[model samples]
Target: MLRASLLASVAATPFFITAATAQDYFDIGEIIVSGGLSPIEANAFGRASNVITAQEIERRGLTTVQDALRALPGVSVNGSSNSFTQVRIRGGESGHTLILIDGVEAAGGDGEYVLSGLQTANIERIEVLRGPQSVYYGSNASTGVINIITRKGAIGDTYTATLEVGAATTATAFVSRRTERGGVALSFSHLDDRGYDQSGDGGEKDGLERTTINLSGDYLLTDDWKVGFTLRGSDEEADTDPSPFGATDADSYVVDDPDEFSTRDERTASIYTEYEMMGGRLTHRLSFNKTKYKSTYSSGLPVTRESEAVKYRLSYGLDGRTVADTDHLLSLLVENKKDSSDDNPLYAREATSVALEYRGSFANGLDVQAGARFDDNTVFEDATTWNVGLSYQIPDTGVRLHASAGVGVVNPSYFELYADAYGYSGNPNLTPERNESFDIGAEFAILDGRGSFDVTYFNETLIDEITDVATGPGAFSFVNQAGKSDRQGVEVSGNIQATDALNLRLAYTYLDAKNPDGSVEIRRPRHELALGATLDTFGGRGSVSGDIRHVSGNYDSQFWQWPAPTVELPSYTTVNVAAQYELSDTITLNGRITNLFDDDAVDAWGFASRGRAAYVGISAKF
Candidate 1:
């Protein structure tokens, strides 16, 4: 009842709606990278997309990439802690989404990237493309793609530094230098937290310590040639509570254990070169990427696991004017990837792929894009995917119509194919999962272009879904489900420049996702809403921003109970506020408070969420 009332109230409010863009409301001239191999203007892109710039990240006082991603339309995030964060898009599974750092794939062996360890200190921008993107990205792109672009060299020499201290004993330091042809950046972050007991009983606090470091640099060989590299490493140690499996006392389901803790270490590196020729109309790029992940868990028996992946990619693009008032671009790509793990000898896989894409823009406000890809796998069936989209703007009406459709594929992971573990065995005969999806939307320029509103509807069907089936008591095996799972949703967003000094933004999503058996999926909220406001004060020297988010009607499984009954999680609302004041031309002071209301919303079953916290920091540029 409360959820319904809130939704109704927000819908009736004229100021509540906005598309996720840069600081402006629906800036059609903005350039985006994830839309295609080449950067394309938002006006010509057909897919539902969002862009969060570095300036916005700083204004909002967001520390991590995951924090900046929350409250976006058709996106949901949940996990037990920062070390295990998972992101789901358009009701798709966590493994169905693909993550890219400067055009390099960043997923682990399981085809999923943990966003908890990605900091925003040196990021330039984040672009999110919703819907199936396998045509260009190949496997593990059944749902969507998140592309993170880091800072690069500036036109002249410059230096920057930042220092921050916050709640939970958190500290951060960042420094960078940029020359005419190259630049380098380094950042270190640490956090020590004394968390509340998840079991709900008064007991010892669960604690955690985490540290992360990032280094990146790039150099320009010539006006049309460039080389760059990025390296990142993170280490985390957290005290964890035991699961509900085999717990005798109800209070013991999620009790903290001093002896139970986990540690994780992750490292990633990428090197790439780009060259342009044919009067700057043709371009070529080659890149190599590698990632390593290791984890150790201590809970009665100590266990450790490790995984690694390597990828090589080469691509070329040709741009020309095919028609009098039309622009065309053709792109070709070839890639090879390999994955391995220490868990089992058979847990190794490799694949090679070829892909082609085309994009065209007309002078009459019409744009078209199409792409196709083929992948050959060593241990699974070969797969093919395709996608097409278009967008049109009506002359002088301030209205734009867009639509997109695509087919995506996701291969089985190494662990799923050859795992030999306690009470669980892998299935080698499993085939790849497939998804078919489409979305249509319209954008309206309202209030004489001072505000904008957008409405989008998306539908998807997943075939050959992967799941584990019980073979006997205390035993299970991976298998492909027979039928298809369905997901559909509506996303509404808008923004209004209320005045010269204030801006308002709103977004709401309604999702209906079901399993093959017509049962509701778990951990996906049916309703999500967000409201935000920013005000510039003190003659533009000071600024303040506040945001409110509400989530409701999500479900989770109680693993402690027999048969693992599913239960609904309590609805939750959280508020965040930030303020910044410029003290000098090159110095600034900033502070923020998160979860101001301290709503204890359980995202995963039996896990206690974090409460209110505050942070303050200073930054300087020289």
Candidate 2:
């Protein structure tokens, strides 16, 4: 019923009476840290999660980070080449989604992550935790978890800069400070794109380049103690178009060369410390992290290949409280990783993890969550994950109900357990790739603070799953897949503040991914939609926004489609618009238009998507 005609068109609008402020952010301070046994409220998280603040990415003029996650709700993103952007959750596998920046372990090159060079300078919000987070993020996260939070300062000193131009060219700078105790932030971003000829029969013009830097700092020794630091870096390049340009057969998608390219040289760093004495409700945190990924490939002949990966992490967290409503959290982790090529070190792995969480909060409001994890991998066996969640609260009818059950894990990378490539012989008894999931939801609240609506249903099961078995005259190995694989979905979202100056949002998803004999899952999509609105215009000094998207069309066949063919890929829609204006008190001006109606897309079945573009910018505050 298309979710009852989109909640009956948001209950037929008309709630415009203005004049009321303070009590939104979805009523009661949004907070979600993987949403389970600790930081709650993001509408009391018990399962589904999606939050993109920073004022909705500056009122939706969003620049990257996959276009602010394409308006949330079970996110799906195909390609636009930030070196091959691909992220899909709920329909899974874009390296099985798991990326965290502020919490370390920035998933990159090795696992899966390439969201269009991710440049959202000094970000300050983006938390989307949709499902089976391996009992709170442990091991490739099995389809969900993207927590990035930057910009740790705001209030006192500030500086900002921005520049934008035509078919992609952007520059940004930011500086920050906050006093009361501590804060610091710095950011830089640059992106260039000439993009848009990704084959489809055109020639050349498949460009992209990026540069980014971000940092955060903090210190506050007393008042319960604290210390922190974070750093991020990036350099990217992309230009690989050959999709159907020179393809004859061999299943229809090609890119052998034409000045091919690929590059990434990333870096991440972290340090942390936090403490609070029992009198302050016992809490602690300790951390250290490092990540470096490098990759390069060329297409000028003579084969140029380079690879590198380095990761190290150490973490600790504790939060305790045992009385009146209960609480508990304890997490410890350690990981050391490596993958290298030109200087040797082709293998190395070390791991240790532990988690235990419990949270109860009752007095009839009912809420309970449980968690467990124990992973100790050095290549295989010794894994255990768990999760359980429930949230009630229907008593007075504001309505809320939630449910969850989880288990997730993935471990087997480095070309999926070592690839020999020349002779194709590498399979170290492959393991880890387990997933089991569940979800249930409901939530509604309308017309008081304005509006809200929610829904969710999910199911998953995957086991072993490694895939690539065949050994004979043409060798092949790396096996595991021997059964179970499925995914189920339903998601609907809503929001309406409809008048204190207009705001609206919508989301939808209906998916069913498979492989237990019901194959068909390449590029995922099985219906998805997103709509948006925001307006404050003129009298409030100016603001306007727009968004629209629709997707449904997927299939590319996972290899060997020799005589099978039938790569159905045909649905698409896109529109975007944005605005901002202030021009005084420190000045501000912004603009955006992306694919405003250039519609004629393809997000993988042969790339090519991106048309009608425009952008303008100005911002200053110093």
Best by lDDT: 1
Cα deviation at 609, candidate 1, in Å, is 1.3
User: Best candidate per TM-score, number?
Assistant: 1
- TM values, all candidates: 0.90, 0.31
Task: Candidate 1: give the clashing pairs.
Answer: 17-494, 18-493, 18-494, 18-495
The TM-score of candidate 2 is: 0.31
Task: Go through the candidates in order and give each one's C-alpha lDDT.
Answer: 0.74, 0.68
Worst 10 residues of 1 by lDDT: 10-19
State how far residue 346 of model 2 sits from its true place (Å): 23
